[model samples]
Structure formats: structure tokens, C-alpha cells
Target: MSLLENILYFQGGLGVLANMFLIIFYTCIILDHRYKPMDLIFCQLTFIHIMMFLTAGEIWLADIFESLNVKNDFKCKATFYIYRVMRGLSICITCLLSVFQAVTISPSTALLAKYKHKLKQHIIKASLYIWSFNLSFSSNLIFYVGGFTNVSETNQMKVFKSCSLFPINYIIRGFLLTVTTSRDVFLVGVMLTTSTYMVIVLFRHQRQCKHLHSISQLRTSPEKRATQTILMLVVFFVAIYWVDFIISCMSFLLWMYNPVILTVQKFVMNIYPTITPLVQISSDNRIINVLKILWSKRHQIFKKRWFFCLL
Candidate 1:
């Protein structure tokens, strides 16, 4: 590989690491009640990130054409369909997570509080609905995406992959683009709105505690630290992903006029899924405690299994 390819491959490895951490986190959340409401969304997000990394990694780490040989129509269709569905679902889930988190911190009297009780249960149903929804919606693209053999006038020709839908009944292309654009707009709005709510609530929380000793408030207690970490995290994620999504939307929407925008968009677009794993490990005590608990349990299980074998 060239230097550029090497860099891409290394970055892909980091992406895998991020995805792995998310898998561990999702697994922990699944087995615990503290993050019950977040379990479904986090699990789905983790799975999506894993797929995103693995598939994208193939482009860099493996033979782009040789190893990824879309050997059959089925493989081609599956790859396109799966990636689109997962991408849509990832954005959708992140938007939901942001809204849910914001709702949770509404101080018990905000009108949004009324919906808080249903958040956990609603998440389960919503997750399933979203997967099914995106899957069904994106399935039509499969009919247009295929690996077909082509013939040329050279008297020596091989399979030349091309889209069956390009120049593509402008109507259908328009429709697909519209659906995708609409969904993006909705999710972006959700992210920005919920993120704004988080900012407001967090500012209020900090204002209330502003008089306390800085060291005492920021470092002395686990609860305060966790809350502080989460608040900071809200700010970080909202700033990063929301801006990314906005730039991406503008890029795609204006691609006809400026194609290079995709290059600008790809950096942020690709990394959004990488956030779930790195979320607060550097700051959030709750996540750290969960990781420690999981590590201890894993060790205990290994010891027990070995002891039983000896017996």
C-alpha cells in the first residue's frame, strides 16, 4: 500500500477499536438496568458502527476489487442494501438518543417530562420500527443495484459493473433522493433541537452549582463527576455530529454544483459512529464503573470455568 493507503488502513483500525468498545458498552448496557432505555439504541448503534468499520475497512485493508469481489448479484445487492439501511438507522438512533437524554434532564417540571416515562419502552418499539422501516424503504434500491456482465466492441471484454438506474428515470432518482434528504433533515432537526435543550438544561444545572467549591464539585464526588461528564459529552457530541450532518447535507444537496463537498463531508460523516465507544471513558465515572464490573465478572467466569474443568 502507498502512504495514503497506509494512513487509511491505520485509521480503519482505530475505527474498529472504537466499534469494539461500543460493542463492549452495548453488552454492558444490555445486562444492566441503569441504562435500560439506552440498551436497544446503543446496541443497534454498536452493530451499525461495527458494520460500517468492517465494510469501509475492506476498501483500505483488503483488495478493493479482488477481495471485495461482489461475486454475485446477491452479494452486490446485500452490500448496498445493508449499508444504506445501517447508515440510515445509525443517524436515526443517534437523533433519538439525543432527544431522550435531553428529556431526562428536564428538571421534572418541563413539559417534555411527560414523555420521559415512556422513553425506555418507546425506544424498544421505535428501534424495531426504524430497522424495519429503513429496511423496507431502502429495499427498492436493490432492484436498481446489480452486478451484471457487459460486452464491448474490443472483441475482448469482461464484466463491467454499472448502475441500472443511472440517468435513472429521473423520477425515481428524485424520489430516492427526496426520501433520503427528508430523513436527514428530520434527524438534523431532532439533533439540533435536543442538543439545544441539553445546552439549556446543562447551563442551568451548572448555574445552580456555580457557587460550590470548584474542586469539591468537579472532582470530589462520583455523582457530580458523572453528571458533569454527561453534560460535557452532550456539548461535545452535539457540536461534532450536528455540524457534521449539516455540512454533509449541504454537500450532498449541492453535489451537482460542487462535487468536492463530499470529501469535506466524509471525514465527519464517517466518524459519527465512532463516538459511542469513546463516550466519556476519559471523564464519565459511571461508564468506567460499568467497565470494571464487566471485567471482574469476566475474570470470575473464567476462573470458575477453569476450576470446574479441574474438578
Candidate 2:
């Protein structure tokens, strides 16, 4: 294998491992109600991340090993369709998580607070809807995506391996692209607006606490910490997502002239999903405590071994 391909595979393998860790962590959170609504959403988000990573990993493998390639048009279409569906669902779920937290931490008298009572139930229903809608919408992809086949002048047939959207009627293609762009734009808009709202709410609350000389009271609250974590998640997600989007556009415009641009786009695209679990753990006291206990046990074992060696 080429060095670059090996590096790509290594990076993808790391992403798969990190996503697995997150899946386990989220599963622990979901099995216990102390974590509640947010944990449920986190679990779902982790699952989506795993799917995205696995699907992308498979594509990379197919690129490397001809035996693993998509052998037929149906497989190509299905692979592309599944990846797009998962990607769309990921965006929608993240947006939902952000908005849910924003509403959860809103002031009791605020209009958004009215829905907070049943937000847990709403989260379940929203998750189901997001999955169903994304799957249905992405089904449109099957009509235009497939493995390309070319026949050479020497009378040999070559089947291109990658899953790609084949060009269709211009109007139909444009419509599909428009629908996709609209969905992304809408979800991103909601995420930004809700995250910004939470920041404003947090700032105002901090100001009020300052006026009352109770800033410490506000700072110590779980809600305040969650607000900060979600805001940070949003910042990381937006930064990586838009950069990937721009790179994707550039790659398309350049049309195979620069392979490096597409590679960079893929790298950026995976950044958010790969690192999100670490972001979550950083702000989660429960997860941190568990990690500390595990670390202490490992450290104690190492110390005992060293003492025995000294004796």
C-alpha cells in the first residue's frame, strides 16, 4: 500500500476506536436514568457517529482492496444512499440535541420553558422522526448513484469502484441538490440560533448573579456547565463542517485536478464525529470520575510492581 493510503486507513481506524469508546460511554449513560434525556440523545448521536465512521471506513477499504469493492450498481447506490442518510441524520440529531439543551436551561418563565416539561418524550419522538425522514429523503439517491463502468478501445471492460452520483437530467439533479442543500442549511441555522440563544441566556444569568453578588452560585450549577459544553460542541462542529463544505465545493469545481483537496475535505469531515466524545467527557463529571478511578487502579498496580522489584 502507498504511504498516503496507509495513513488514511490508520486515521480511519483511530476514528473507529474513538467512536467505539463513545458508544460504550453513552450506553452506560443510557442504562441509568440519572443521566436522563440528554444521555438518551447522546447515545443516539454516538450510534450515528459509529455508522458514519464505519461506512466511511468501508469505502476506504474498498478503494484499497479490489476484492472489497462494490461489485455492482446496486451495492454502489446502496452504499452512497446509506452514507448520505446517516450524515443527514447526524446533522439533524445534533441540532435537536442543541435545541433541547437550550430549552432545558431556559428561565422558568421564558416561553421556551413551556416545552421543557415534556422534552424527554419529545426527544424520543424527534429522534424517530429524524431517522425516518432522512432515510426516506436519501432514498432519492438510488436513482442517480452507481458504480461507473467504462469500456476501453482494447475491448476490455473496467468497472469503477467508488460510490458516486452519476449525472442525470440536469433539472432533476439540480432539484435533488437543492433539497439537500436546503436541509443542511436549515439544520445548521437552527443549531447556530439555538446555541447563540443559550449563550445569551447564560450571559444574562451571569450578569444577574453578579449584580446579586452570587456569581459563584451560578457558576457551580450543572446547567451552567452543560451550557458551556454544548456551546463548545457547536463551535467545533460549525468550524469543521463549514470548512469541509467549502473544500467539497472546491474539489467539485476543480474536478480531479487536485487530489489533495478531496483528502483534506475527508479529514475535516471526520474531525467533529471523531473528537466529539472527548468534548463530552471533558464536561461530564460522571465520566471523568470513572476515568480517574480506573487510572488510580492502574497506577497502584504499577507502583506495587515497582516496590516488589526494589525488594
Candidate 3:
């Protein structure tokens, strides 16, 4: 198709592949009893991202629905609803990830340290609550979103090619927007707070390390590296998320959608999910070691085949 379509396809394809790989890696680790504390959270986040890309990615869900000859209204509602749910889960899980990482790296005497022992038990329960809350929170999408038709008589704001937001009472819209904004602000606030705590913890940790060892002798712990990676993710996520949030809020409040603005927003939305796996793959020693082992085995197999051919 066009250049934009090509880029969107590439982004969606890459994100889906990377997230799938991460999920598989996590699965293997869990099966082998070598899983880390963050493994479960990472797995959940990747799964939500995969769903997000599949549902909201430019042509993915729409193409599938078109092939199945689904009704446009149903398609719009389903796609938007599912995408919103996944998006909500993404932020919630990400916030949880940051908070947990902060707790994970906190000093033993710190207030957060008290929760460390109960982290495993809390993760599942917290995830369930998050899922339930998002599922309920996004129910408004089903009522407000529907198939876009060419009829100008109907006041609908087109978002996707086939989906538009139907007008609702201003009071209802205001309430929904207020609630949604509140949720986002709360989660993002938590993410930033935890991230700041982590930075301070990391700073103190580095100072202690320098005091105890020479510069060349100082080594990063696994927990420290994981914290740093999550920190990087949080910063990146917050930056991109706010951009998307601002665009979305403007569109929602004005009840207007510009094609160019929507396109940019979609691209921005995809960036975080697309980049997260690459960051994890590069930064995680466990995944790196596994890749190394797999590569060595493959190389040995190739060498054996070449030797046999020579004979």
C-alpha cells in the first residue's frame, strides 16, 4: 500500500513478534523453574500489548472483521472495546510493574520493604482487580462507539475507518471524561512517584557501592539492572502516553478527529509496545544467556552437517 500503511504494518508485525517471543521466553523460564520476580509481570504486560496491537493495529482487526462479513456496528464496538480494555490493562500493569520494582529494590528498613514478602501473593490478586476495573471502566465505549457511515445527517465523529463515536449527552460525556482522566492521572502519578523513589534508591546504592569497591570492581546486581530497565520504560512510557492522552482528550472533548492527528496518535501509541521487548531482550542477562546457548547449539549443528557433507 502506501508508506504509512507499510510503517503501520511493520510496527504491528514487529510488536506482535517481539511480545510473543517474550511470552515464550517467560514460559520457558517458568517451566524450567528459573523465573525471576518480574517475569510474571513482564509476561502479563506483553500479553496485553499483543492484544492491543492485534485489536488496534491499523488493518488487523478490521481486516479480519471484513473477511468475516461482520456488521460494522458490531465490529466497531468490539474492536474499540477490546482495544480500550487492553490499553487500560497495559497502563495498570505497567504501573504495577514500576511499583513492584521499587519495592523490590527498596532498602530493608524502608516502608516498601514490608510488602516484599507478600509480593508473590499480591501480584495475582492485583492483576485480577485491575482487569475487572478496566473491563468495567471501558463499558462506555460499547454505547458511544459505532460504525461510521457517510451520512452527514448523523452526528458521528469518525476515529477509525469504520468506527465513529456517537454523540452523547454533554453531562454524561463530562462525567466519563472526568472519571477516565482521574484514573489515568492516578496511575501515572503512581508510576512517577515510584520511579522517583527508584532513582533515589539507585543513587544511594551506587554511592554505597563506590564506597565499598573501586570503580572497576563495582558490579551491577540483577535487581539493580532490572530496576534501571523498568525506569527507562517508565520514562519512555510516560512521555509517549501523555502525548497520546493529550491527543485523545482533545479529540474527545472537541468531538472532532483529524486524519493526520489520528495517524500520529496511532503511531505514538504503538511505539511503547514495539520498543519494550527490544529493551528487555537487550537488557536481560537471562534472555541473553538463553539466546547465546541457542546460538551455540545451532552453530554446532551446522558444523556437524558441514563435516558430514565434506565426508
Number of the predicted model whose TM-score against the real structure is largest:
3
Q: Could you tell me which residue pairs clash in candidate 1?
A: none
- Score candidate 1 by lDDT: 0.61
Rank list by lDDT? 3, 2, 1
Q: Which candidate, 2 or 3, has the higher lDDT? A: 3
Model 3 weakest lDDT span, ten residues long: 214-223
Q: How does each model score on lDDT?
A: 0.61, 0.75, 0.88
Instruction: Write one digit per residue (lDDT tens) for candidate 2, span 112-176.
Output: 99998898899999998898898898898577566655423222111123545454565775676
Q: Rank by TM-score, highest first.
A: 3, 2, 1
202-296 per-residue lDDT for model 1 (tens digits): 67666766666454463464544444544454455556766765674453344331223433344455655555567645565566786689887
- On TM-score, the stronger of 2 and 3 is 3
List of clashing residue pairs for candidate 2: none
The digit string of per-residue lDDT tens for model 3 on 1-311 reads 66776787798899999999999999888789787668889989999989988887535778888899999999989989999999989899999999999989899999989999988778878888999999998897698888888637787888777888888788998899899889999999999999999999988888988888754433557777788899999999999999999999888888878777777788899999999999999999888998899887997889999999999
The top-ranked prediction according to lDDT is 3
Model 1 sits at a Cα RMSD from the real structure of 6.2
